[model samples]
Target: MASDLSPASRRRMQLALLLTPVSLFFAVFFLGPLAIMIATSFLAPGLYGGVEWVFYPHNYGRILGFADPAFEDFDPVYISIFLRSLKIAAFTVIATLLVCYPAAFCIARLSERSKNFCLFLITLPFFASLIVRLFIWVLILRQTGIVNEMLLATGVIDRPLELIYTDGAIVLGMVYIFIPFMFMPVYASVEKLDWTLVRASLDLGAGPIRTFLRIILPLTSPGIAGGAIIVFIPALGNFVVPAVLGGAKVMMLGNLIEQQFLSARNWPFGSALAMMVMSVMLVMLFVYVIATGRRGADVTN
Candidate 1:
């Protein structure tokens, strides 16, 4: 009496129902702003701050070192900033991975109560405002800051080191802030790990390092990749950390975009810069997806 739908039809109906809210949410929130931003990138900047409805590519050209208004000389300043941002972002990903991997393993190996406490401590910093946390680093890194004071007391140096407003400071801040992001995904993967595989490898002829390189790393790679993407995407476009710790000396793509919009009143150029960042992020995510997919295929085979 109640046999109106096949299994496939029922599954399709359930999926559609489940996806309706998420689809609508993305359409309104994510896609809506993204479409607006992409459209704005091609438009002209208004006389002052806003955008005008006219197509222009000069904004992008300016960023790429063309569209110079004086002497027709090639200006590599913006290009340098973009590349510097990429380098810093890559460094942050590597540093965060190095720091988080061991910490994640320790957390994974802990008792449930200890694991929760460790996780809580790791994430407790998030409760504070990011700006506040960055400012604390600023205090710690400034020439006359705690680090310099301690060194001076120990007679380690005659003068304070130039820590703030430097590339190193920016990288340090980025690594510290993004470590939690990197740790969480790796921890999730480690929590699901089959320890029996690890034991079997060790019971056989495999050393710890060899077993980890061949077995453990491959199994947990998806989480590592996911965490790296999470940390890197944000670090690539980070503004506040650089702006605060860098003293505006170190600049990233986000800082450049923020400058155009806020200082230069160049909305079109800012939009273009934002679009470029999004493009890079998309490319990285695409590569990650393909690699992960290939790994999954290999596993199945």
Candidate 2:
């Protein structure tokens, strides 16, 4: 049948066959749930849990302030959660970058076998359950956990200090999980780095700091930006880490959204919060694309 058809016709058929399953998968799995969530965002919450068919714009209005007087007043706590989540995510990105950037450089300079071994070590966490990995930190950070126990044994402190359920703990956990995500991109950039330019800058009477700023940093920036974006996006919406590390004392947007859906039984409100998170992600992606395009143009020029 393919032999009888024109080349263009056969190509079109092949493309159709290749795209059909992907299209169906996205439609059924991705777009399907997205459409349902968007619709649910606009619907009213029922007296008994679940959604009411009536269209209600207050779902969003609740977040932005100006919620319907009959239901509830707009609370600024949601806004605070949004800001806190953003801060934590940003910190996670910065911390992950700091840890991965220099490590990438070191790994890039290693022998092939050493590089592979280092990569295996970096990716070892992924083999285990995420919850299990997080619990290890919980044990290490808790009052009677490893750190405090070691300190107490050495008489470093009179009592165990609070290590877990704080913003720092959350950021630490995020950095641990996201190390691989940040490392791979940075390593790719570092591996491809034009080291000749670095040597030239150093030879031209430039200081190490100046050479890094003018040559090395700019060369490796794409990987840094990419790593930051990937790390930030998931860190922003991460609930599990915050739940296990932050506890009730520290609430992030992810935890807030979870509470609305599970504890409060307000799906519409939860969907609204989710939409807000998605909006922030889209905005960041747009900014990243624009920045990347401009950088590309500058490089070409």
Candidate 3:
């Protein structure tokens, strides 16, 4: 019904129209903030607050364990913090995989309705705020919490167990928070698994362990990799679980970033910390891609 515009022109125009919103969104929300953060990282710390216009690489040096000129010795605190964050993140990934594999497998084997229900229950926590759910755990783990009261009533212990505000509780909170991320991906892979291979391996006199290690494991490797990456990245940067559960005793990379910005009033240093986190996240994302690509290649071979 329209004008003398050529078909090609109309198609190009339609394509541009479709892409406009997403392109604008990416430019405005993602790239703009990223550019600012990177630029901020290079700026010197302001005399009192924020950042000065002067270029400075010292912020990164500080995080990398170099001492400022005033100090005689190098400070390794930030380096240790980064290492601790990685360790916790790695452990959480392993733990999540261990817990999710069996649970995902069970769900995969269920009747369709039951599988749907189980998956729904697994994801039901999303309906509530994460902080609220974490606080619920706090209630159950505190000295006067449900667990302690139950143990007391049963005469299992005379005193309450120390459950909250510890590394163990922080780990528990992180695991609980991120388990669904691990489970959903693994469940998808398990649901799509070819059980014929498992049966065939068993028939060929390969034991359960051997069959799993050989055939079954390789097939679902992609899902496990995806889940692990998903869990690890967020866990690495997590501040909330450690804050609420571990209290002042625990701090992760996210907390470090938060502290620099909010408490220390060190914008340049905070920006540097943030950019490091973004870089680490990018590396993890690349690893996820490569690992999944190799798994796909192996499957093809």
lDDT of 3 by residue, 1-301 (tens): 2579999998989999899999999999999998999999999888788788988888888888884666536888998889988888888898889999988888898898998899999998757799998998899999999999999999999989999988778778888889899998888888889999999999999999999999888878878988988898888888888888877877888899888888899998989988887889899899888877786798699
State the TM-score for model 3. 0.92
Model 3 alpha-carbon drift over 4 Å, by segment: 69-72
lDDT of 3: 0.87
Q: Across residues 129-180, which tens digit of lDDT does each residue of candidate 2 receive?
A: 8898899999999999999999999999988999999999999999998999
Residues 198-242, candidate 1, lDDT per residue (tens digit)? 999999989999999999998898999999999999999999988
User: How far off is residue 219 in model 2, in Å?
Assistant: 1.3
In model 3, the number of clashes is: 0
TM-scores for candidates 1 onward, in order: 0.86, 0.92, 0.92
User: Stretches of candidate 2 above 4 Å error?
Assistant: 1-18, 69-71
Task: State residue 208's C-alpha deviation in candidate 2, in Å.
Answer: 1.0
Q: Which ten residues in a row have the lowest lDDT in candidate 1?
A: 67-76
